[model samples]
Target: MEADEKIEKISSQTLISNSPSKRIRIRPLTKASLVLRGTLVVLVLLTAYTFYTIDVKDVNFVQGMIGTAKNVKVMFLEPHLSHFSFSHALYQVMITLGLAFLTTVFGAIIAVFLSLFAAQNLSSKRVSVVIKGFAAFIRAVPTVLWVLIFAVAAGLGSVAAVIGMTFHSISYLIKAYSESFEELDKGVIEALQASGASWWQIVFQAVIPSSISYMISWTFMRFEINFAVAVAMGAAAGAGGIGFDMFMASSFYYDIREIGAVTYFILVIAILLEVLATQIKKRLKVNI
Candidate 1:
């Protein structure tokens, strides 16, 4: 009788503890979730405050929209270069390409040597850490800022642009190249070591050959980035390219047609570069 009574009591206790009402309650929210919610709330409050405080009493919304439409029509429908010829624009584009190419080549050469020391599998832990940390710091700063800094010494021109772009590219490529190198198979490295091969021999025989495809891909990607940066540097650093001509048209002359013409040129060139890169990679069968 006592055992039966105890069993009934335990069964009743379990039923109370595991009630449907208790199961319906939510699990505890995590710290990340709480912070995300808080950030959203803060942003919403700030946006509301900004909208409340701004003065738009004198604004003419309809006129502004009509003016914008007219400007767009003028730009796209009628685009012609009044100040510069087509050949000049093409030459300027070539200059920009040259800048990008030079920077990629120089940076890749330097990065290859530096990354050999930065790869953890191939180099000492201390050296790898130092190289990676330094590269990170260099990459933290904007490429434009680096160009301006070099401009202080080299003056604002192609020289400053090339040096600054190359500086940033080296840091970027170091991290990329080192990571690729580190991904090499440990078994291959060990076998080479056991066979009495020197470090350079092992690198040439196994590492470079294995990672060449990836390296080429990374280098080309960097080239594309450098080309865009060079265009911007042309206007900002006085590097003199199609970008400079566009800046002159838009800012000095206030010519929408000229701006549109420059935009078309840049767009066409960019498309050609993409096609070229794709074809080259396909021909070489470079995956990844």
Candidate 2:
């Protein structure tokens, strides 16, 4: 009888404890939620309508690929020394690499200063807002367009490509760096201030030290982007690089093998960069 009573008491207590808390309550949607849903629905409809209007009557999947089978085979099977000499391809690849490196370094140098002022935690709200707004304006324009605009003054070539890529890189880095710096512990900031640390001292000792890893990581990511842009600008802005060779093969003739070789080189370089950045991040143990 004692055992039966104890078991019954435990079961009754469990049931009572769970009764109120275990019930699932549906979230009530407010006007803001309704507006957001309505906006999403409209955007989806617009996207569907746009795709529906495209002309696809001439498209044939098998027929299109069948025509390029030999070229494809040569490209995939024979990646090198098919169309261009090895030395020439190497030169172009080096140019692309150098361009990316230079742009990344230059942009990162400028972005560090800009980010110092852009961060809300470090600067006045008005100044941060203004700086951010300016960066947004610059970023809103496409990379190619920026290059083209600079081309008018700098003339078309590697110079234009470098300037354009750097402009976008700075804007990108500033945003990333500011956000990382902003994430520094507020309590740490308060302690530093209480210890009579000046603004510059706080930033140099606290912010930069804490966020340097993230800064490096963001810069590496931007380098990858700038590299890709350099390739495209080489073709578009007459900036001589591997992209120029690829562009010629694709635009001028049916040089399938050359296209394949250049594409392979680019693919390898991109993969290597990604691997390097990943390794650095892992080694540094970057929190951001």
Best by TM-score: 1
Cα displacement (Å) at residue 32, model 1: 2.2
Encode model 2's per-residue lDDT on 1-288: one tens digit a residue: 999999999999999998977776596678998999999999999999989896768878588788679668988787655567888888998899899999999999999989999998899999999999999999999999999999999999999999998998899899999999999998888999999999999999999999999898999999899889989988999999998999888888667777888988899999999999999999889344
- Candidate 1 vs. true structure, TM-score: 0.91
Top model number, lDDT:
1
lDDT of 1 by residue, 1-288 (tens): 999999999999989888954756475779998999999999999999999898878778798799999999899889999999999999998988889999999999999999999999999999999999999999999999999999999999989999999999999999999999999999999999999999999999999988987788899999999989988998999998888898899999999999999888888988888898888789768443
Which pairs clash in the backbone of model 1?
none
Task: Report the lDDT of model 1 for residue 132.
Answer: 99
**Candidate 2 local distance difference test against the native:** 0.90
For candidate 2, the per-residue lDDT at 110 reads 95
lDDT measured at residue 232 in model 2 versus the true structure, 0 to 100: 93
Error of 1 at 156 (Å): 1.1
